[model samples]
Target: MKLLQRYILGELIRVFGLLVVVLTIMLVFVGLFREATERGLGPVQILQIMPFVVPSMLPFTIPATLLLSVCVVYGRISADLEVIAAKAAGISAMRMLAPAFLFGTVLAVASFGLTNYAIPWAVANIERIVTQAVEDIFIDMLRTQHLVSEPSRGYSITVHDVQNRTLIDATFRFRTHDHHQITVRAEAARIHFDLERQQIELKLRNATYSNPGADSFGDWDGTVLHLPLPPQIHATKARHLTVADLTEKTKEAVLQDEIGQIQQANEAAMLMLTGDFHQFGGKEYSQLKGANAEAVRNQRRFKTEIHSRVAMAFSCLFFTLVGGPFSMLQARRQFITSFIMCFLPILLIYYPVMFLMVNLCKSGTLDPTWSMWVPNGILLIAGAMTLRKVMQH
Candidate 1:
């Protein structure tokens, strides 16, 4: 029994390792190319992020690769009559399948760790690399083109020359938040990025500013102007956050919603006591309701994200359970045919259901804690029935 388990496990590991490596490499290149094309990343930036990209791709690759490996190893063994030989030797089907289950359990835990921990770390590093690349691109545009315009950011910079890191005879034009158009001319200027604050600091020397709308002009020996960072550099998605961070953020969102509700309730009571019934449908009340609704959506989004991560990770085990028994049942067919028979349904049914459940969970139509597990539950039932059939025969 010990020898059989080892043999099964060794075959699974050998096949899984090869498939994962091939799949991960193919995926990593696709990821790199996408990032490069979308973010305009150069060779240096791509190389810098290459290492971090592997971890992000692993969680996606592991479960499918494990499934394929199971189909390959078990389908082959069964087709070779080894499973029947073991059964004739008084080994139960469950006993023979123990190694695959154990392997799947370990991979499931690993997949979860990759998603919950490794992914966050990799995303952070990738974002940092992309941020630096954007900064470099911005500086390069200013140096080569001698002008940079960002309509979305409401700013444009033109320079006579870029010497080293300094801009000589620079003119900066921008629109303020209050719709004020202003221009500043500087003898020399330097740009600095404050990533922590998500802002850019432009240090100017011998600067003169003019506001044509206000018909005002000013001069300063030196001053620093702050500008918003590019939107692409901002990483606020819940997927980029760790589970602990998501939990804290979810609590904060819920607390804000509760506070807003309480405030609105108190205001409504005050209006009632003062007989100001007309204020019940006021703009302030409408705004307060909107804010509360936004908070609720945010909390729901965070909860869904947390549950989806765990459910997606455990798909490794569920895929194994279904694939192993189903592959054995198809032992008369080729392993690839068996794999397609098993994976085709998953590709068609499992992912769509999971996607639908996630969207419903995010919209607050369903509770994420249970809804996210619907796909896995389907797989478990199918696996159990198939395993029973395998056992009886």
Candidate 2:
């Protein structure tokens, strides 16, 4: 039994490794090309960022890769009559499948770790690195070019030229937060980087700034313009937060919601006691407006995200449960055919269903606790039926 387990486990591991490498490389190049074109990233920059990018891709690839590996390895083994020999020697099919089950359990744990910790960390770092690279390019352009236009940043600047540390015929068009346009034309400007404060200060000589809609413009001599660059490492997106972080955030949200409910109830009681029934409307309780509504929505998303992570992690086990029995039934078929048979449905049915569930979960149409596990539940039932057939045969 030990030897049989070792043999099966070794084969699965070897096949899994090969599949992971191939899939990871394919995904890496896809990402590399996309990022290179989008960010105008040089080969050196892409190479620098590649390591960080792979971790994010691995979680997506691992479960599918595991499914394929299980199919190929187990299908080939069963095709060669290895399972028949084991059964002839008084071994049950479950005993032969023990290693596969163990492998799936380990991967399930690993997937959880990857989803909760590694992917979030990688994504946050990628954002930080990309933002810093853009900032560096902006700084370089400011130092060398007479004119610089960054469409993404919504800024256009033109100068007669730069000599020593001074600019001439400098005009800058900046978009304000309120969607108003601010155009500043200066006779001369001095560009200074405040290293201590991490700010860029443009000291304008004989400048005027005007709103496009306004008839009149304000003029100043030797006006100092200071703009602070974003810090190198911005806060990670709430969705990218770890499970522990999300748990605390979820608790706070729940508390706030409970408090709001209590307050609303108290207010309703007061209104009723004071005979102000007109003040409360049917729509009032159902309608969550402003920050309160936003907070509730965000809490739902956070809860959903956390549940989805856990659900995704366990997909390793679910896929294995489904794949092992499936491969055994198709044991006599060609390995490639068996692989395709196992892989296609996962791509077609499982992924689409999983995506739909996730969207529903995020939109608050479905509860995450139940909705996230629907695909797994279906797979589990299917796997059980297949396992029964395999054992009987």
Candidate 3:
């Protein structure tokens, strides 16, 4: 029994290692290409981001790779009469499947670690690389075109020439936060990226600023302009946050909501005491309502992220649970065919249902703690039934 378990575990590991490498390499390239196309990353930036991209892709690739490995190993074994031989030796099929279960459990833990820790680290490094690349891209564009406009960011710059890192005869046009159109002309300027603040700083020499609408102009020897960073560099999305951060943020949001509710109540009581009932619909009240709504939305987002991360990680175990028995039942078929047969329904049903649940949870329509596990529950039942069949037949 010990030897049989060792043999099964060895075969599973070999197949899984091979499959995961192939799949991860394929996915890493796809990730690199997508990032390059979106961010205009050159060859050097792509190579720099490759290592960080791998960890981010692993959580996505592990479960499917494990399922295929199980299918290949178990399907081939059952087809070759190994299960029958084990049965004749008084070894139950369930006993023979113990190694798969153990392997799945390990992979599930690893998947969770990848998602909760490695991914956040990877995303940070990737963003750092992309930010530096963007700086280079920005300078390159100015060097070639002598003009760069970001309508979405409400800014544009035109330069007479870019000499190395310096801009000669640069004119900057942008909208202020208050919707004021301002233009600045400079004899020379240098740009620096402040990543911690998510802003770009322009150090201008002999600069003159004018408000076109007001027809106002002023001159200064040295002027500094700060512009918000590009949207892609600002990654506040829940997926980029670690589990501890999510939990901390969720708690903070809930506390803010509670405090806001208390303040609203107190303010309403004060207004009623002063007989200013009309103030209930004032701008302050409306702003409070908006803040409360945003807090609630943030809470939902954090909770959904926490639940979905765990659910996605545990999918490794569930995939093995379902695919192992299912493949054994389809042993007469080719291993690839068996793998396709097992993974097709998962692709079609499990993922769609899981995505629907995640969306619903994010919108506050359902509690994610249980809703995110619905797909896993379905797999558990399917695996149980399939294992029963394998045991009896």
Q: Name the weakest run of 10 consecutive residues (lDDT summed) in model 2.
A: 282-291
Error of 3 at 363 (Å): 1.4
- Deviation in angstroms for 184 in model 2? 7.9
The number of residue pairs in model 2 that clash at the backbone is: 0
| Model 1, span 1-393: residue lDDT tens | 589989999999999999999999999999999888877778999999999999989999999999999999999999999889999999887887888899999999998898889988998888888877887878888889999888999999999988767889999999997899999999999887776678888899999999999999999557998888887676458887899999999999999999999988988899899999998899888888889999999999999999999999999999999999998878844878888899999999899999999999999999999999999999999999999999999
Which candidate should be chosen as best, given TM-score against the real structure? 1
| TM-score of candidate 3 on Cα atoms, chains taken together | 0.87
Model 1 spans with C-alpha error above 4 angstroms: 160-170, 184-190, 194-198, 203-210, 215-224, 231-234, 263-287
- Pairs of residues at least 3 apart in sequence or in different chains that clash in candidate 3: none
Q: Can you give the lDDT of residue 393 in candidate 3? A: 93
Q: Candidate 2, residues 1-393: lDDT per residue as tens digits?
A: 488889999999999999999999999899888877876776777887899888778888889899888898889989999888989999888988888889998998998898788878877666656665765665557567767775655667788777655777888887766767789999988876554355557899999998876655899678987655434424456657799999898888878777777767776888799998986765554443333566687788789889888888899898988889889888954767877887787789888999899889878899999999998887899889989998999
Cα lDDT listed for each candidate: 0.90, 0.80, 0.90
TM-scores of all predicted structures: 0.89, 0.76, 0.87
State candidate 2's TM-score. Answer: 0.76
